[model samples]
Target chain A: MDTASVTEQPVLAVIPDDGVRIVTVGLAVAIGVAYGILHWLNKRSSEESRVGAIIRHHWQPGAWILGILLVTLALPKYFTIVAITALSLLCFREFSRTTGVFREKTICAVATLGILLLNFAAIDNYSRLFFAGGALTVALLTVCTIPFDKPKGYIQRTALGTMGFLLFGYSLGYVSLLCNTPHSRLLILFLLVAVTLNDMLVFLFSAVGPKSWLLPHTSLGRTRIGALGALVVTTVLTCFSGMVLFDGTPLAALVPLLILGVGISVLGQLGDLLVAAIKRDVGIPETRPNSPNRGGLLERFDSLILVAPAYVHFLSLMLGPIGSDLPQRVITGGGP
Target chain B: MNDWDMQPAKDLHLTGIERSRSYVREAGLSESLIRWCWLCGLRNWFCRWNGLKIEGLENLPSEPPYVLIANHASHLDALVMASIVPRQHRDRMFALAAADVFFENPLTAAFAASVVNALPVWRKGNQQVGLKQMRERLQDEKSIYILFPEGARTRDGNLLPFKPGIGMLLAETGTPILPCYLNGTFESLPAHQKFPSRHPITVTVGQSIDSKQFQNRKAGWVELANTLKETIQEMSGKPAPEGLG
Candidate 1:
């Protein structure tokens, strides 16, 4: 609960850092069980069984993505920053491609540079630079196309560029900053597992209640059971995981832990709905429906988009400012 | 004010070689960067090493949705025109390249698609389908196409007959076509020679011809192609031989 204690990290904290060892072990075991279930589901998934059909359709790709996250987390801390940077880039790429904003190379390049600088700022523990990145990027995006002198489609392109940078570049930048914290490796794993479980649990528990649509317009699949499942599963997972991840902090308290769990699940669902709304608005079909192909990376991590920022803020609220204890601006070299 | 104004890139669903060879491919920032840098370096090389010179630059259109039709005798022709493209129009310029040659493999396909910003015209496939798609892209994207209406590169130092492919792209369209004559490219990089040799090349861009005057019919396309071919011949200061149309 004290700022000093939050900053105090053991010098020898290596990859699969003390607390993350548990998460890694859980993921390693889950990988095998997931594949086993997928193999079984593939053989027996008929139209007759709705549960089996749903599991068969999504579990393989979901497990594969989680497996990749596990591998990425088990690497050195610097690699976590690299992975986050790549995630931001890919997300921007998909967003730009989907919205026809990629044609505005000036805006896209500024956004791309902003995303890189965000990760750089986070890596150097330069909170000032990191915090300034979003506004600076939006400013650049606004003025980037002025030289072209063509005012037609100006509003559409600038708005798209601003939104894309804020979501994929700026918001996702928080994940890396979270990794720069004292117990970053564990935090990353905890957030990843919690959000993944929330999404998964919601779907799995949807078979329980009389399936009625929660937001029929935004999404056809989000049901009352799914919403309740998200609330309960994410809350419990957060409360349990917070015990270890926030071992010495106020976040480990019963009320705060439960709140963190609920916040994460709620934000996670909102993130998912945001992407669904984007796809619908952009007029792209839900391509994975009735198709055997794996879902796009955009679809897989859609929930993490919003949850990442909220989780980081939750940590900051409870454990003091992340990266505040470390020497700041290691790259730019000013702040202490 | 347009409804659903945020349409995705035309090539969003395509991947790998399919994306590279597809007619609907749109150049992204990566491709634009590659083509811009590619053209910049090539411009220097052609200007310095090949002694390239240009005239009648005034005839070049202020914007795109225009065609740059030139004689094809060497690989240097496309490379030269590609290098000479204005910086503002770099990403918008696409050359109609031979699918059998440039798009034969991944490496070449990438070069043709990104560096050259080319659209593959399969010599054997449905010409109408590809032409229709390219025309739509040219209009929708406001593209500038570098076309060699001679169809294929000539082996000897003589110009080939004008083909109807150019007509297919321009027929009934309001887009303007600029007839350009490129001299000494055949000597620099002839059909038999894979690499270009040092040679002074003079490029002459003539006045733009509005294709709105031509009908969208087959006969109109042929007449338009002939008119542009003759314009280039006159610019080249060489009359077509009795046999060559």
Candidate 2:
């Protein structure tokens, strides 16, 4: 396969008169305006409120802007890869900032940049060996180079860095690689839609559901009713979206997709908890004070880091090799 | 010291004597009831204040007689751990507190006995008696013992050297040690702070490591202590104790 020809060719056609195109453009503009207005209001409100002053003192606006840019640009296939790269960098930054034990920032930066390059190479249809080898080398080098001064700090930095590589680099790289596969762009978009809907439903459940003081020690602040609400909403939305977007998907595939949605939602919650766990360990409440970002890098990209890997691995199994005729068979249940 | 001798003072025609005696009794009761209530209250308040997060509660065994060993970063560690344990099991658990500190005053002693259900273990002298008492508590089929193997609050919120008492306790009791790691407690209430600041605290309980795993080891007690500290460090995502190096 000539990878250069594929990268050079434009994948999406512009539909100037299409209703979907109009709707997309209109929605984007409206969201942009709303965000601008919210930002202004937040600034004014912060100036007026004492509580907001304390918050603003600790907030990192730059990280928030970068995070928003990544999420917004991720809608386009090409930009999605860039967004993933940015996410990886931000996550690495967040991990390093909160963890005082990581003394080798230069090494961490090099390893993180290598992972991003590997991700881009994977997306551009470069040799899988290159991606795999680079990932392995980075992992090995990080583990070996960590100082032996603080045994706990050494192990923690290594473990966290390795986790970031696997989660942000390899898993996200596979998601980008999907864009090159036939009908895989639609699959990537479908995954995002399902995930967004899942997040929305979970947030709604947490906001409106009955509150329980039980397990008040947890950071989730979620009640049993809220969890049930999230589960039901995620399942229904996944199945409905599958029916609409992937009509040819077999019942077998649909079942797994439903399971995947629920699992991702749970893992997303776990991801949130994991980030909180780190903050708790470091005695830092949030990374906003140090990073100029309100939610911090870990807080913003945590769910994506966790879900991206699981989604890609599951997608690979569901849709065999990139050009294989197995996707159709699997969708139609022709054979194992 | 005698109940009958105290009754005459209670019966004396002192205008607020009854109310004062009742207040004393209530204060004593408050230690046990107030301790649990305070724990629950603090958990809720801090969860709201700093947005606390907890995970891996499922990893904790429902059965009893397990030794809960955790890193001691602050004085709040015991309260935080007790708050997370299922309410059903809280009554059966006893926290091992420094005997000199908790038993220094009569009121504190009563409160410790009633609310905390604290087992007063000597920090320095009389190791034999303290060990015997701890073993006796562990030998009971229904009792749970919570110990901070670090011996005291860490000066810098880092895991300090593990006291040999834990190794000795494990050797004698041979119970499953549930290694717990508490995060953010130092900032919430550091070593010198008398009151906890509004900071979120998280307590992670790792899988239980059986005491029998280290039984009869030829190596020194530091080896077992290192293993236990490493277990907690892994759970907390912190560096292991420096002494292991």
Instruction: Give the clashing pairs for model 2.
Output: A60-A292, A60-A293, A61-A292, A152-B239, A152-B240, A153-B239, A219-B52, A219-B53, B32-B115
Give the DockQ (C-alpha) for candidate 2.
Answer: 0.01
Give the alpha carbon lDDT tens digit for every residue of B11-103 in model 1.
777666778998888777777887788889989999998889999888888888798899998888888887777899887889999999999
Residue pairs clashing, model 1? none
lDDT, candidate 2, B68-160, per-residue tens: 888898877887777676765665677788777876666776666666667676777767666655666576535678889888888887787
DockQ of 1: 0.49
What TM-score do all the candidates reach, one by one?
Answer: 0.89, 0.43
Q: Which candidate's DockQ is highest?
A: 1
Shift in Å, residue B168, candidate 2: 52
- Assess the local accuracy of residue A91 in candidate 1 as a C-alpha lDDT between 0 and 100: 83
Off by over 4 Å in 1: A3-18, A27-39, A46-72, A143-155, A207-210, A288-295, B1-4, B239-242
Task: Give the least accurate 10-residue stretch of model 1 chain A, judged by summed lDDT.
Answer: A9-18
What's the true lDDT of residue A195 in model 1? 75
